[model samples]
Target: MTGALAVAEKVPEPLSKAKTNIVFATIVLGMLLAALDQTIVSTALPTIVADLGEAGRMAWVVTAYLLAEAVATALAGKLGDLFGRKLIFQLSALIFIVGSMIAGLANGMTLLIIARGIQGFGAGGLMVTAMALIADTIPLRQRGKYQGALGAVFGVTTVIGPTLGGLFTDHASWRWCFYVNVPVAVIMIAMAARTIPRMRAVVKPIIDYAGIGLVAAGVSCLILGLEWGGQEYPWGSPMIIGLFAAAVVLLATFVAVELQAREPMLPMGLFRSRVFTVCSILSFIVGFAMLGSMTYLPAYLQYVNGVSATVSGVRTLPLVVGLFVTSIISGQVVGQTGRYKYFPIVGTLVMALGLYLMSTMGRTTSVWLESLYMLVLGLGLGLTMQVLTIVVQNTVPYAQLGTATSGVAFFRTVGSAFGTAIFGTLYTDQIGPNLTDALMQVRVVSPEVAANPQSLRALPTEVSAPIIDAYADSIDHVFLWVVPVALAGFVVAWFLKEVPLRDSARAGATDVGEGFSMPEPSDRLVYLERAVSDTMRKARAEGPVAPRILADAGSDLSRGEAWALGQVYLHTRIRGAATLDAIAEVHKLPDEVIEPIYDRVIGRGFLTEDAGGLRLTDTGRAEVDRIRASWQRWLGARLDDWDCSDPADRALLDQALANIAAKILDEQAREQEVAHV
Candidate 1:
């Protein structure tokens, strides 16, 4: 994980730009469907209710879709890590088209809900696979712009969803809401099948079944509790309480199970990263506020404000427009400058301000004013939302990219669910009594309307206005509550320490601040110092650390030559393979120079050479063995640098070098093996 494999200088010549674009377009279209489906159903609910006669089950339509999607997101990311993104993506597209067809042709509400769940599953795969593939294709430096384009796609889809839903429901049929996916999915599937290059699967990790079970059980229970508690059951109902308790136990068991597993679904080491932990927290908070608020906003516009579905669709444009502009700008800035900490800092602050501004809205407040508030909030969200993903991915090594990114996505979904439930409760508690009071004043309430609070919206204007006003008041309070959550996100954004974005191909090759070359070793000075020290140690009353005071200093070379040559004699002596006195004579030096080399070599008993010169003694051979052993240890410590297949062999080579060094000195060879493998 520490070292990166070097990338080829360019992609293979056989790959064409047209093929690459086709692949890219497929991913984009898939992502568009996922983002659009999240909001599209809200605009078509009325028509769906009239056809199916299940207005009471309306919330489940969206809840079931989201719940299925959330599970698929994490699962798809894991599958891509084990298999290949191209394969999973193609399969997901096929599943999506099939689900869309089923939903479009369904007769009953139950069947349609099940079909939506299937559609949600496909959406999840589409999102995770699309994002992960982008990372694989693009370099980190250029990825920001591509990620920005994804954000733009999401923004456009969010605005388009409601409008498209209204057009389908008003002019044709509510079934088109489901059918619209067919053609787009078919195109995307064909594009993907034609363009994405085939790849073999990686060696799969040992599957941790117990950990998977606990995670699935835990998240499912928790999400169900949030989705059902306020609407289908009371807050303190036994079923709700039991589900919450089950979630806690299952989640705790998941952690324990993963810790014990040899190959964990979620690696515990990921938590060791401070930035990853903080990013997960921020993602959760953002999801909680964004998804939860967006879920009920359409209801407020239609049921509370007497607006048609088309008008509500048009009115939400400001939010999407704000997101589009800010997302693109932030992406460009982050890519060019390589400094992104400030965007989130500024964004979270503005988001909190916008939430605070939204809390001030009343039933009679100006429509433009509300739009302005949403626009501000959307812009702030756009800047911060994707930036955290960038920071988290940047903090980890490339092999774990899909896992880390999906982990953030999973936490965000949890936050969104919790946010929706809490706000749902707050709205119900505040609106119910105010609605009753408003109806009493109008004096036209029926038993059914009183019993089913949802029916109050269909009453005459005189009877419904006051009740709708109460909804506006309560929803504003929900926004007021969200301000604090947004503020907490701002605090979380503060701790992200910006590390330099390194190019993956060059990650472990060299220090970025310096050029690629390593300095050559200077062994001449090492031998010179060793010789001088040995001479002094051997001399009982040596004058100084000078070379001549000791005997054996010029055993092969003459004193005069040793004296004149000084330290330069060490390199010359070794190269010539000469005796101590002969080397000294050749350089025309005194014992002072060559004496050091002779004394040191003799003392260490490692001066190996031929009969033509002084050779290593038995003790010198042992010393060489010790040096080789030390070198082997040094190389062993850096085994992580070796690739999977090479580590054991590299360690063996290091040990072999050590043995060779030792054997040469032991045999007192005239020629020594220095540092060869």
Candidate 2:
């Protein structure tokens, strides 16, 4: 045991600052590949349709990818936990590269759609695993900065996707859009192989294939119904009706299965927390508005404003700028203040206002006015986007951290799919009749030209004016319908309870290593209380007890001195001086290192040096009591609603809580001993 402790102490910590930055950069690259792919093909769709001669089926390209991505995201995190994150991450990147290559070489619309589905599947895995890896690697206190920067990447890629697609379609081939992911994915795969740590579930792995199948089928059916209704099939048609019915039945089955599964993919228990439920709903709404708006805005600009595809992409910059700036600022503020509830509330309200403004836009609305509306919408999404994930991470137990994080992401992707589908339905329903009527009055445009929006700019002014007005009116109505969605999100944000963020270094130590261990809830509570105390002290500018004070007190204690003091105080009260010597000897540390820490405590009046060796003064005893109280309060907050009606279970919890407090003191003593050496 002594030799093992000595060797463990000698091992350096796994993640240094430079390594963290490198892994973070690799994560961001993987995330960008996924995020950018979501929108990059939008500008190339027309070219693809023209070449493939399938004008009516163009929407399927986007829909297929989204559907597949949503399913992949829903399962990726659990697979990572079961298998191992590094292996899954690498596999996901490789899949993405293969899918991208297949897409680039696709010659038919059907083949392209299949390729896109493959790409989406790979992209989905990349996104969820990348996010889970971040939680695994980075400490929570500093995660916001990296997460915020990732949000910026999403914004930049979203804004530029269309422009880049347009440039490639015009100057090069439309295939480049898919080809673009290959090199970036390759680079990500390389970095991940070298930098990402191996982490796997400590518990025995169980495959929840039934739960996975039910949920995937349920979500797939739901999206398919939404996509085909009012476009390919009537709302009352049997196909749509059957799809919706299957969705409900399958989803219910999934819930039932989760209750019994040894390791369910998405644990239903997490939804018991009000914070998790509210943030999830908010995430859904944000995805709805953000993606729905992005889908239609460019079409509105090109058809109504008579702009080229590239020009339309460039004009949407204000929205991206607003989103990028606010996301970073919000993340930074939350990191510093540890207050997050306000941002989402204000964000949703602003989003509703922006959608309302967009609803009011008409055929004659100036470009500047439209840009201003987009900026407002972007700002609202920015504030809401990154914060919800951060909140989910903060509240969930480390055991469910990956599952919870991916669950929130899965909702957002599902929301985006539904939003785009419904928005398309509304636009097509409104535009079909209006365009037909306008063409009858002015025969300048052929039915072919009217069917293909890409050719709308080629029509003369007299013929295109009515068509433009029809498009503007249809898009305005789509925006009007979404106002309610954003408003619902705003109301839900009000119910989000603000929980204090946990310190990553203390609470997340287990998260970083190879073997997973589920610490008892009471053990976690003890660590949580100590972390909270450290945060409070730092916030009050009273942290990192001065080295000079240690020197003045004739002790060579390090920053870990408080922990050592607490240990000495605990040992003297319980098992006597023999326990202290045992601890030092077992850890293979000299007695002098342990002795000075107590000497410092004695000098500070928290302890007294006497013939008995050492004893806690009144102040020291009071401090220990305070630590106990803090742990009790933290545990109470977490377990308030937990069922404890059985006396045996309740007693077990009580004993565990008391044991954890002592365990914390012992662990700190060991760490301090190493630091002093």
Candidate 3:
């Protein structure tokens, strides 16, 4: 174990604080652009269709992007591992810029749809790689705060996207929606090139092209079937039936391929854990409810209530407000209690109740009443969204962290695609017949005026009443149909087993360095108390402990201090010399900064100056052994808790734990080594 730790210590030092921040900022910018674009084009869709004269194919504008994004997300993470994250991220940004430019200048609907698909492909790569970069650059202890901030970014973009789209569509050309992405993409690309680090996977990467192709084909077929059934073709028609059958066969084949592949894109082994399975399902439901509802609600507000695009966007603020408030509160509460299962259960129930309430809305339903319903739904979504991802991260082995994280996201995206398609089908199925009946009753409305929702506003109140009612009823039915889906999610939430969240990065401490040598449990206890104190302070400010506070409880040792001690122990045991200058050089800290820490350790009698260099005392040797034992126990307990039965996995966990313990020590050592300088 000591020999391995010594060899591992030879790796290059981490980036400086300034460089890390720059890289993180670049990642967030890319993520924001990708996330923002997901919904930004929605409000402009009606105007886009009107200008292009393709009302019947308008849904394709969104569907093409979604399908391409789903495929891109599933494959991008592996690509990042095989090549490098910085290169993949840069390529993604460049593709997005090109796609945005093409979409902005597109002369017809077909060209626009193709452009959106291209944009979606790029966006998918950006989203996945942005997340992986954080895991790469940030320390495990600080990850929760940054991850929380990223989640906030998603929420902000989701709320503001429609309003931004509406503003551009109403005041300028709808082309501005795509055009707006160009500048953001250009800036992100510049930052990434300058700051993003080149990180390669430790193990040789094997591309799972067969698995990728099968899954992509399967998802595309399924989405097409859902999108076209009952609208473009009868649900029972051979075309729809064949698509459905093909989806099933393709998906089944994908599962078979993944089971045999060396490095499967999806990694079917993760499903062995109950937590991963449950979280994936819950994530799917959340996406289904969220996008499905978001897609149609604006139409309801505009067509049924006779509002402009801007007003419709403004009216959805109640839901956004509800989402923001609950998300913060839930995070804070979970940080304090470390209890997560309840939030999803309560969230799904509230979501179902909200949907049921929405189903009861009629033409006479007041705006305030509708707003209240939206608030309930938003609150439900907020509570569930943040927690589900945390649980998945908690359960998976650290080595598979990126894959697990992306897997949850992949399921959510797939859910969004299916939700939008199924909801569109339900809305179309109801609205067509309802409109026919409404026109028959209101004879004063001309067929041409009735066909266009924008013209409905000019009609007399008597002529528009039935038409408005028809729109209300169709939307109501859509909500009613979704209630069962939310309810099913509610039931599933009850089955989610709450595992204690670990604070250390999932990849384990070995990746960071080796465990620091400590004299006794009492000495370790002092550091543990400090870690707890620091965590409490951070939690009070940031919200709940969530996953951030797990193994990382506030410790007395700073990251640099830990690193210094670990380096000293490793050098004394194996490489002979343990001078302040040598430690400083290895860690990229100045000798002046590390001098004080060496003085402190010598003062404590852990080291003594000799002709060879600073050497560990007899006490120091015993302390190093204790630290190793402590880390082994800690790692063993975690593996047992996870119910890892495989002997190979247990061995990996042991090595990883040793590395993680060393890392914790290295982090503290480095902190002190650089503190004075």
Candidate 4:
């Protein structure tokens, strides 16, 4: 017990200013790299295909990287909790560097795709680990600012990626795209090694191999179905339908497996927390629209507006600017004010409006109008995303920090993948026929060619121009379709309760002093005492005293209560001693509350209280002695129970209990000596 008390006393506070800044730097820089990589490659891909002589296999480059990265992210978080954060982060950096090397060295599409997969794995670690690290080091009060900063960086990266990619692709080789990670990775690794301490390993962790397999399989099937839809097969094709069914089954099994596991990979109990559950729902919706919108914007700009990759990149800047401004300001405000419930409510509404505006784009849409819509989208995202993460981290205990943080990242990534795929399918379903009919009517496509859906992209500009416009228009319709989906996020946000945010120092002190479990209020204890007294008195009644019952009742009463009454009896008797009237005087309690308990005492034969006074018979005295003997034995047993497995806690509780017991024994011995005298 003492050791437990000591451990409770030693809970560490939040990181210092230097550490907080480093953590903030780590999160923002890492997020910038992740978000930038996703957009940067899109602008450079055309150049990549032209140089590598394989436009046919271009989509695989993006697909391969995303698949690999998504798979690695889910596990990296668990690894962080089980092993150590420092090792996982450092290893992720090294892996990214090596992947970067491979990508830079690649001479063909095949080699580059393979290398991209490796890079994805490392990128996955970076994304999840950075988020987890932020939760670990920052206090809730200030975490919003840091999380918001990351969101801002993500926005900046979105705008910069295309421009930077275009610049690199136009002036330098496409290889610089991968090479950019080198210096960033080096800096991140160095800083993290210095700032982040190595976390101790858990005593034992039960790896949910079955759950991992099920979730991986389910996600893979779903992603593959979405990826292949519209492009490869009809939406209702047997293969697609089968894959969807398999996804549902596998995910269901994963949930069931998690429940049965002793130490689950993803704790089922986390779902019970309202904050975690709601935040996860919000994340999924954000992922769906956020990734879907991003995927199509560059394509629309380059394909329909007839702009250069650099210009297309510039066009996306308004959204990023809005996001950056909102995130930074909201973060500081949230940290200072310590309230986060309102951000999500406002953010989801803004996001819905942004999506609605995005759905209205057209071939004839003005550039300024497009920028206005992007700004709305950016503003909405800035408010909700990071704030949701803060709420989750605050609701859970410290030990589950890594797991909880990683889970958020995993859901976000999976949502992004699913969203991108669904929107891709929607765009394809609407565009294919519209493009063919328009080309045919314009007399640019022959009847034979118009009938063949696959040959439309190969047609000349006269045929393809109207067709591309149709594709862009249909794609905008898909974005419109998702407006409701984005709005649905608002429903989740509305349920988010306002929880009190604790500073890291105060949070640590609470963990050591009390615990994550909420303490009962004093008023409730007073009510409980009254209830107990009422229940005990009404339940027991005084009747003809049963000898056996009296004996048992006396055994239940403590020696302290008996001694208190005995002293009162002797004191009152001495005041009227000359008569020796064969009477005992005892403290009398009012009948209204005390009569029932007093009746039980008499019925049990522990004591008889009448007009004369209360008296303890021979059996009552013997029962008291028996009760004391049994109580002593129970006290001895409690010492062992208090000696927990933790040596420090055991030593502390042991010493304290031993000291108290010795004092008790000393008092008993001194009283015996006085009686003998």
Candidate 5:
């Protein structure tokens, strides 16, 4: 953390400005690849099913990717910390490239679903590691601007993904959607290899293997039960019931495991906070409403309204724009005033109203009406989704911040998966009966044409009427069923506690990018570093930092002595010895400029000079340690208001601050990374 560190820490010299730009660009590309893939398949699904011919299994394309991505995101950060962020990032990109190739070539639904799952796993790593790498590489003072830019990428790409997918499906082929990531990923990998520096965690990261496994397995089982119910099996069939039972048992076990786990993947204690608990539920509902609508709207437009894939995507813009605009507005308003209890309360109610309105659509519903319905749903979701993480950040203990933020994201992703699965089950169950009944009444309409929307659309208006009506009814029912879920969220939102926002959290309240939440974990040390940076940013706004810091330290040294001592200590670690000439050369100065400082340092008995250049005396090393301790004390005073009263939590916060202090003091003092090659 920083108090003096704001003006005190040197710019880590490993990266020049050019190198930082190249590294940031590469990270943005990889993150884009991961985020873009999430919604890219939505508009393409109808076309993909037309080619692959397993319409019933269509939702699996979306669900498989989501579940796989969830697991990968949960584990990727720890994996990066344990190994190295750069290597893991490259590996993730490679995995994604390979998965894309397989999906592009797959000849059957089973193979395609498997390939999509692989792609999702890689995408997860790309997203989480890319975010972590920013922490590794970016300077503290500039991290927020960079992080906000990355968040904006998610929002912008989200708005475009469905439309881009539709264009590819219509112009080239549905497979091109997967094929496109390959070349982009290759370029990202190549640039990253040359430009990004290698970095690893300062300490071993804890991975909750059992918790991750149990939750993944349990969620998968639950998804399968919902997906298969009423289609391949009856709701009460042995197989469906078994899946549900296994899900409940596994999830319960996962909860038990997390409760006992040291540094649990999701600390059970976070749910004890009313804000965190309520926000998590609201996040799940927003995800359910948002994704469920995004995934199915294309079907209604393409099948019932007889629009092409590209046009269907274009029509969905209202929803995306509504979401984007409202999220920005809500984030800005909430940031200005620390009050946010009513956003979710109002949001859920609006979401329920929107879904109910959409559920009333028939085959003849006007395009304008459809767009308005979509817009309402989007606005509701946007308002609700953006604030949940911020609220959790404001209320959770400093030690639990990382897990709580990620925990809310986790619930959102899982909710999206569940929503798609449930919506698919509802559609599959209803569509068959409605189609079968229509086939009897309209014998001239063949089953084959009915299965393909493109073929059915070419038929005479009279012949296609009944079939289109059937598709509309099925989609309408899916929305009708989900309205209750949104209403449930409305009931839950009433329980949200409006905690006053922390000053650090309040600083970014107006950031539009903050509304675009992704399932990425925060590093506790990195977050603490940002918090201190915020303090310094405000301090810099007020006046000078160094004088205040010096007054606080009350040490018997001038700024030059401290700067000289720090450089000498750092030089000895890097270059084996710090000669006056080498120090002068490194700073691009003459010996005349450095000689006097060296003589003063030598005269004080803090440095020893000989043929070995210069080395810190034991006394000098202690002085360096003293500066570090001062930094720690300054950091502690600033964080006194942090809610970590439990002795264990307080200890963790202190340890995190100490680590931050050491990092600030040392900056980038890595031994040469031969492994990077």
Candidate 6:
């Protein structure tokens, strides 16, 4: 049959506001749970190591999750396609709860690290599936707005995580760090089951199993080496040497696998685009700066400032405020004007300045001074972080869109892993020697008391003075070393050529989520729809694409006439009937608003309202098909550049185009204006 709504099979029927809210709530919760975990363990890490007695390996508490989450993110999209988005989403939540319980129950560092990994794996699934679910179920007209809100959750979580973690650690126990996820996730799961549609992806995304394993092992080896070197073992030790060697070999192998894989997770081809290349580099450093700082800043607060976990979390607010303020502002500015090349350059440079300022913090630094420094760093991060994803999306080919977007995120996560490990290494290497010298002046400082920030703070001022200085100096050491990394990003940012952002970005498509750098999965079709919508809206290409082709197709119908026919056709095709009432309900407008359109179509003999329901006449059906074919030709003309050498690839691309053509409903006004109401 010549389908009128073939493109809409991928998108579920539009939901009522109540239903949308329910679905949106579930998506936001899933995303919050995942993104929150990325940094939530920060404030709790100090107390966890004190309780577990593996101070040297504390970084793994955060690193294990990041590394595992990175690996899981690579697979989540494909996995969702293979099974079902809702199923994968629920399973991911279950896995996360299980990991959380295990982490909370664990008595040793080894078991805790493994549990965190389990949690990270689950978190990754939650993050990616949440994004895919949005594309799968939400109406295309409203998708960008929701995506942006989800991104805001990520930015808010960066601040919330540390504070919430600290609250649990100070008032309750460090184990509650992971335990907290259980209740929230349980609620999300229940809500998801009820609200999220159970639909499987028609297109089977190629899963790079070997590539996932290779990258997982490679990144793991690399992170483990960074975390372990000069702390658990000497940098030159056989174990450390082997880890780095394995990392090099495995990563090199992973790159080789990507080059050959049918659908590589991080396509080697993406680097050819100057924007992708520079954005990837800057993204890594952004994650490095953001996550790395959040992970350890609590330790500096607790030990150096003699603040409790909860207080330390609050103290970090200046940084969060800076991040939120700039992140939002940058997004708006970029949306108004398509220019964005200057953000990364200025942002990275400011980040370096922030890091340099932070390096000067010591035992004598006041809380207010520390906050100012943190705010500066946050401003720098806010400026640099949000623009990369937007620019890269605009720059990369539509075919490689999904891969490139995910690639930017992958680099950022990996960068976070590296940053945390390096931070831990610097702090660990410095603290021991620095403390040994400082403690030499004190007669008897208990090792246990010295390690526990709370216990050490209980000591007399003079007695705790040396330990505080040691802690302060150690943190300062990390900030000082990391300044160079931020500077490198600044250097790379200069090479990032400004690609004009699509109208979608100007329409606020990427404002919330992309700016804050959410761990979003790639869905090229969804993105393309938004971009096209934005372009049309910006150019005043109002109404439907069908009218533009009607002139060429020689259709007699007016723009509203085409829209009326298209809507009735889609409605009848999907629900087996179309009615004025049904159209009003679906669009959430009144009968009066919809009756005018239906009156014209029925009067024109295109549609008939019978006892059974609304039916499209033969003429109406033919016009719809002709309009669809014209759209197909239009798409084909623009998409011929895609390398579809393989018949299977060609079929997939053709089908996608056809669906897109059909999906472009001959509607009235704009989806944005209607959907918003």
lDDT, candidate 6, 274-341, per-residue tens? 87888888989998998899888999999999899998888888888998888878888888787888
Q: In candidate 6, which residue pairs get closer than 3 Å at backbone N, Cα or C atoms, i.e. clash?
A: 151-513
Q: Using Cα atoms with residue i matched to residue i, what is each candidate's TM-score against the true structure?
A: 0.66, 0.72, 0.80, 0.61, 0.91, 0.89
lDDT of 1 at 52: 75
lDDT tens readout by residue for model 5, 205-291 = 678999999999999999999898888899899999999999999999999999999767888887888888888888888877788
Top TM-score prediction, candidate number: 5
Q: Residue 126, candidate 4: how far off, in angstroms?
A: 3.1
User: Which ranges in model 6 have alpha carbons more than 4 Å from their true place?
Assistant: 1-8, 536-564, 571-618, 629-658, 664-677
Q: State residue 376's C-alpha deviation in candidate 6, in Å.
A: 1.1
Could you report the Cα RMSD, in angstroms, for every candidate shown?
17.9, 9.0, 7.8, 19.2, 4.8, 4.1
lDDT of 3 by residue, 208-324 (tens): 789889998998899888878888899899999999999999999999999999767778989998889989999889888887787778778877887777777778888778777
Better candidate number, 2 or 3, judged by lDDT? 3
Which should have the higher lDDT, number 2 or number 6? 6
Q: In model 2, what are the clashing residue pairs, if there are any?
A: none
Show model 1 residue runs off by greater than 4 Å. Answer: 1-13, 46-59, 80-87, 105-112, 131-151, 190-197, 205-212, 332-339, 397-399, 428-437, 443-461, 498-677
Off by over 4 Å in 5: 1-13, 555-561, 569-634, 662-677
lDDT of 4 by residue, 1-677 (tens): 21122212221233567767876786566656665776677666655755675443554566566666766676665576556556777787888888888988899998998998788788777766666565455543344355435544555666788788767765787799999888998898888778775553333234567877788789879877876765677779999898889999998998998889864556787799888888888877776766667766766676666566667677878876776666666666665677878888898899999988888887678989989999999888777765655566566543344356556656776676677667766766776677667766687566444332234446676756676577577768877888787778887788998886644312222111111011011111111122222222222343211222224444454333343223323333333321113211122223343344445556777676556566655765566545444333433342232214556434543443333222222223223323432
Lowest lDDT sum, 10 consecutive residues, model 4, at 513-522
> How would you order the candidates by TM-score, starting with the best?
5, 6, 3, 2, 1, 4
Per-residue C-alpha lDDT of model 2 across residues 1-677, encoded as one tens digit per residue: 11111111221123667988999999889888887888887766656765775544555677678878877775665577567767888898888888899889998888988888888888888877776666567643455455545545655678788888777776788899999888888888889889887766544345678987898789878877876787789899999999999999999999999999976777899899898899889988887887778867876776788776677677777777777667767766776667888989999999999999998988788989999999999899878875786677677764465467667777787777778777877776787788788888887777667655568777777778888787788889999999999999989999999977654322222111101111011112223333433343343364322333334334443545556555655555445552446446645667777777666767878777666555667876665565555544444444443333556435544554454444434443345456555
